[model samples]
Target chain A: MNNDILVTQEIGSFRKPQYLSSVFRKTSGPELSRLKEKATLETLELFNRAGLDNIGVAGEMYRWEMYEHVAASLEGIEFFGPVRSFDNRYYRKGSVVSEIKRKNSFHDDELTFIMNNAARKIKLPITGPYTMADWSFNEHYKDKRELALAFADILNEEIRHLYGIWSKSKSEVFEVQIDEPAATTHPSEMDLVVESVNRSIEGIHGCEFSIHVCYSTDYRMLFEKGSELKLHGYNLEFANRDTNELGTGSEHRKAFAELKDYWDIDNTKFIGIGVTDVHVDYIEPIQLIEDRIRYAIDAIQDPAMIRVNPDCGLRTRSRDVGYAKLKNMVDAVKQIRKEY
Target chain B: MVKIRSIEYGLYPRSEHVRLSISKWERNALDHKSLGKLMDAEKKEILKLFNKSGINFYTDPLINWQDILRMVASLSLDTPFEKISRYRETNTFYRQPLVESYPRLGEIREEESTPDSHLPGSMYVSDNSDHYMYFLPGIESFVSMSFLSPELNRERVMDSFLEIYLDLIKKHGMKRILLFEPYPDSHFYEGNWDIFGSAQVFYVRYGLTEGSFSERKDSGPFSLIASNEKEFDVAARHSEVPGIALMNSQNTYLENPEKLRKSATKMSSSLKLDEIFVTHTEYFDFLPHVIANKKVEILGKVGD
Candidate 1:
């Protein structure tokens, strides 16, 4: 696959540490590093089974969403937020440097210290710029779309900087993925979303681009408009039964495929089907994964056109369940590929 | 603990006179199904229906009609609402429209937030029970209120509608008048209209200390806010009974109707508003329930 397609573990382990604000505990660094290393090991093993040569493992966290409040409460300070919300679920603070520095510091000192030795691609997960902007109170712009585009402009610069780091690290592959749970809520924003994405990804060539849309119900609402947005592929829920949480079932899969078909899946785009169920404790057998994969491929009417992943970020489930689910999914997909 | 043992009895009518008035005439504008067996097939039974109604303060004469159009239809740019074109159908409603959606705007959404959003002029309940009107079985926190602008009447046709209404009330004993929510496009909604009104439109604003609300303080977002903002952060609080009134005129609200009766020895209070009205209607079957609520009192005969 050359360096064009960086394989997982073929690179190095991913880093994720519980970040603390400015205060350092005596054993904090070591404790963080140990956890990160364990997570990296689990990730590599799962990706290896899933047949991902250069896979990266990461987590989703709620601590960030309630950041200002969390920060205030933890520090015993009353806080509305660092960023006030126009609606909610977003903040309007922190510069790119500060954000990256904070993230990298936690990943490196606390998480990376142990995680670094493990071999895998260390990917940085960011809440997509549009979602970050959308979930926050907007101003200095007339239209919401304009605000989103402006946010995207700043984000594009941020991604370029991260990619520069990947280049200097001497790593064969470095990746960045945008978590876009809010994309589906304001489907009316879709008219200009594709153009905004192009602006964000402009000039950042050679790095794989991934956009994940979550809180799956948004899928049902803005599906027709969202399918047309420009992105390497989309990651969505396909099997959650909980009504509160987004669920993607056979019907939803078919609906997505239908919209994608309307968008004309002409080799230029790829669709990622989440194969692992993020909810519930029971493990799905490899055969069921195989069946779901078959269903997705059939529904899309194209095998090469699909990419497989978990229903959502693994941060939600316990570390063991997350690890097992990922391993099971990858294994099943590998078997399905062999049969094909 | 303060032993606040206060005597409680039903409040008597402030007026000593037994007020008796009936709607003069009733007519509907909308197309309605037949009231075939409901009206007189043999010998002018409607007159008999009226004769039989022993209308009193609590007894209302059933003047089935479309009141707003009779009053303000000419003001509307759209087609003026015509009569129901049918049915003197007997309808009885237990729920008051005024207090429908209590503690939350104190009114229902006019069957579905469209048809009734304004207040008409003075309208009183009829007490005769020979025939019944509709008894809406929902919440009744509102006393239907409406206001209309004069900008309408591209042809200035409203002048003629007022004539029809005044004549109807005088002749058919029209105790109530229906009014359209005066703000343009407030009365009708096909959905996606930028100009529809809020829950405030359904309520009548009554301030006792009022020079007028605009002339005083404490009137927040509910009073002078722009319609464009589509916001009313400040809820309206009026001590007057009907939290919000509805199109039906038979209802009124008194926060403590029971408390008004403490002077019963001097005033000889007893009759619930129901006690003052007609002899028929099933309201008596639920009499115990009403009395229990402290909403009504059975004062002995007025002058006995």
Candidate 2:
């Protein structure tokens, strides 16, 4: 097996530090600002402590969920009394009204916080156009495809501003991970999904465009149309679907087999296989992580293109569980690196 | 004569079927027969709920209809490879049309794969239901017609489904066809001339919004699937057709009908609806509450 493959990064959103949870109720003012800054610093330090190769700038520190962060950054979005939530715990964002427009490119405060606090180059996770449109109740757009493309234009403006911000930091490889949890739900719109995504990243040079999906999806379709989008990699959820299946030859080795089938056909894009399951609180043993990684390498037969990460964000998990999982993952990668 | 009136649509709750069975099936815990049995039970329950709710015309409850792309491809396309028709997803799963998959798009004959007769035991819900049962075909299935030849107009996609409709009419004495179109604005509907002209064509869009309920004459009278009074108001004002007010039980979204009472009362007083279909077909024990009172008859979609 080729030993050049590297395991690096967290998917995005880490668990909120406990110290700031109590103070989150303060909607605004100097106290909220100070707490946000503290959370940002603490999150960056945790990344350093965990030894993640490609550090993730924690978007959670700002206290907005994935889609809401993008919603908050834009103009023409009116917040109604209605609040939508997936789990009814960590996030509850106001349901939107009116046509979403680009009032500003990106959230300058979040960008500034990351620029000041991040010790290394970061992976910026932006909610993709397809997902943004899918999660919201549309008030303005006539067609679903049209709404998605308009969001693409909005996201593109944000990406251009991000490019300008990161350009000053000398971060040559800016990986902008587009989170599209809604793509698979609307399968017939796959063409529009890819097209809108491609449009969002158009003229975005110097940055690596990676599409991240938290659940199992049509990865093959993404690759079949990858040549057009020119996607650099895919961060997929595997471990959560089959937590018990580990190593190369387990009888229940469906996840790895699925990955192998995709790689056997299209191996051009980088594959970041999720070694840790984020839904549960269990801290994966370092040995299990080693086995999962080895099994993935064995399945794909190319270690050069493989990377390691969690199934999705650890926002739901406790801060301690999240950190423990990250450290174990990092340690396992180090062990595998030494063996090679 | 009483107009043969009804609200026609289908509901596939993720909690009850696809996510419940297939995830276990993928892990080899549930065998194919057992999976089928489970789905059959689910359908029976869904239909029972529909019957109780007073809905007359409804589509079959398809548990794993998401795999519809593959199913339709296998039944409608002349392609040999099953892999081409498989459902794919990274964050989510959906099927692309055969036109997107085949490079020789213009050469294939999809009609050749059209069965000589309606496939028996295809929709068990339709076979067993007491109401005017209908079957659903994805919009992508219709687009397969455009792949039949090089000079194919986009309208031919709609025409292809018309052929399927006629075949069903001959074989099963089928009365109506419901097309599950999530995004109706994206496709061409002109080729559906004969079907629209002669047969009852119910274009079912699952989640209703005010934007979907339009004033334009081209936007066909919507059988609005609303969960709240706001939506009911939109439907009442814009509907050139009847309205289907979805009960909270049928939707993942939670809305207070109590909160909707004021608007529902106001709209009912002003708007003259030809018919009103109260539908919540997913819950077996669900009995829909009448939300509107007007001079016109507010009927259950079909029967009690």
Candidate 3:
């Protein structure tokens, strides 16, 4: 698999093994760590077999839901009952009670483990400050902007710590994907998203940062205002809104039309184009995956600026389906690279 | 002091029993009849709580509804709904109906056949009992959530839908209806407000005026939800509506009854209206059932 032409990466999360998922919240201390490590290794092996160039945190096995994971780690945040995100899937939302402070490191252990064990490059996916603020109840801060900036400070510290861990092991530039699923949900809050996201990676140097936003109704706000963000790339979901028909034309690939809008405003950043729908189990055929990537390549006009990934996270799909989807995605990229 | 009244409208949270039963039914482990029985029991319990709490005018818990728009669309509209879209900015999602063309009022009548035929039986209160509010999506909200065909005129569709809803209300003997418009801001079309002025309808707006709470002149039969003290102050001064729901129902934190009562009393004193309705803001579906129950009890105390 050639990484130069187009890199195939696991964007955010993969479905955890049954053993770990069954007792994820029940077990703790050494037992929990053992199970998480075992699951992470297994997931890494799966990504390796699927021919992925960059495995993101080995499917984020060390965490549960993105917002809750970070919220649970911080001070002055109390989790409420589970709320439905989509379908039957639920995540417990948290409220900021007082001043939020970092109580513990969110991804140090996972990054340390991945850096030591994984043979491939790793991209650490952290829930961005804008998302954390948006998903939470803002009782403490004067406004959501203030709360998001507060989270940005906490994230900056956590990212600095993670960067320290990664730099010690390898001199290669570490990749940090700030996952902000709520980035474009509020049209008026584009400036806040930009400010908070930029604040998150403010002082960190020698890191290739990207933002992963999934299922946005209108990405025009993000595309128009995305130039202000201090990010090197954008990993966004398009397959969820696109059709499965095999064609590279604009009508057939209507969702990727936004890629042109994005490139028109700013073409400097690499875009991780989501080639497969992760919500459903229908594994996109290698040919269909190729068309999506080709459509994106045509829009961006540079194969090097495109990265191939699933729409969002594979956690919603089973391991078998997730593996098959990624396998097809990798195969699609391999086929497209030959043309280059 | 202005007379205080307590009421609630919107989807309540499902109990663990109901939620689990739904999951089981989806997996084919439980039958539809069995699931219905469980949801009925939960609804009864919620009704009993409302009665005991002295909340006279109440809404059905809507325990069985997936969202505010889905049930109404399925029961009323002839247009086929397609994909599940995110409901407002909340984590919950609903099946968005695709409006291919301007729906005719006659089409709604044909779809319903009879007024009672289209109404969800569980949503209706007993004939002998006191009136209960019915929750429906506002025309603007429905249009916003729907997938309108590019060729269709949006204003015509909205007007037709409004007529259809008004007709339904008249035939079904729905006394009070809460039109949910959960926009993050308070800006609503002035034209729609003129139409709603003629009906016994209250525009329930959540996430009102994010940073600065602008005084909305002649809000007209609306209930503004104030989650915090800052919003409460803004809503108290600016809201010309007869009622204002206090405390965020989406949050699970059990608000102190004493603090809530103090805030309610303060708010009541400032409003010029003779009486005001105090209730929880947003739907209880965002919270767990147990937490929601406690919040209900707390609301009772605050209104006292």
Q: Please report the candidate that would top TM-score against the real structure.
A: 3
lDDT of 3 by residue, B39-105 (tens): 6667777788877876645777776666676556655556646556677666566667778867654
Q: Sort candidate 2 into its docking category.
A: incorrect
For all predicted structures, in order, the TM-scores are: 0.43, 0.57, 0.84
Native contacts recovered by candidate 2, as a share? 0.02
Off by over 4 Å in 2: A1-4, A81-97, B1-276, B280-304
Candidate 3 CA-lDDT value: 0.77
* Chain A alone, TM-score per model: 0.66, 0.91, 0.98
lDDT of 2 by residue, B120-169 (tens): 12343554444654655545444542233445555554555556545554
State the TM-score for model 3.
Answer: 0.84
> DockQ winner among the candidates?
3
Lowest summed lDDT window (length 10), candidate 3 chain A: A80-89
TM-score of predicted model 2? 0.57
Report, for candidate 2, the interface RMSD: 12.7
DockQ of 1: 0.02
lDDT per residue as tens, model 1, A1-340: 1222211221111222334211213334656445444555554555555456445433322123322211221111222112211101123232121111111211223223213443645555555656654444332356557756765765676677666656765455455566665665555666555557667778887677766765443354434554455556555655442222222465434434443442353335555666655545557767666666666655566666666666666543555676577667766666666655
> What is the TM-score, restricted to chain A, for candidate 3?
0.98
Q: Model 1, range B142-245, lDDT digits (tens) per residue? A: 12221223343322222333333344335444332222221222112122111112211112222212222222223211211111111111212221111111
DockQ of each: 0.02, 0.03, 0.25
Q: Give the Å error, residue B59, model 3.
A: 1.3
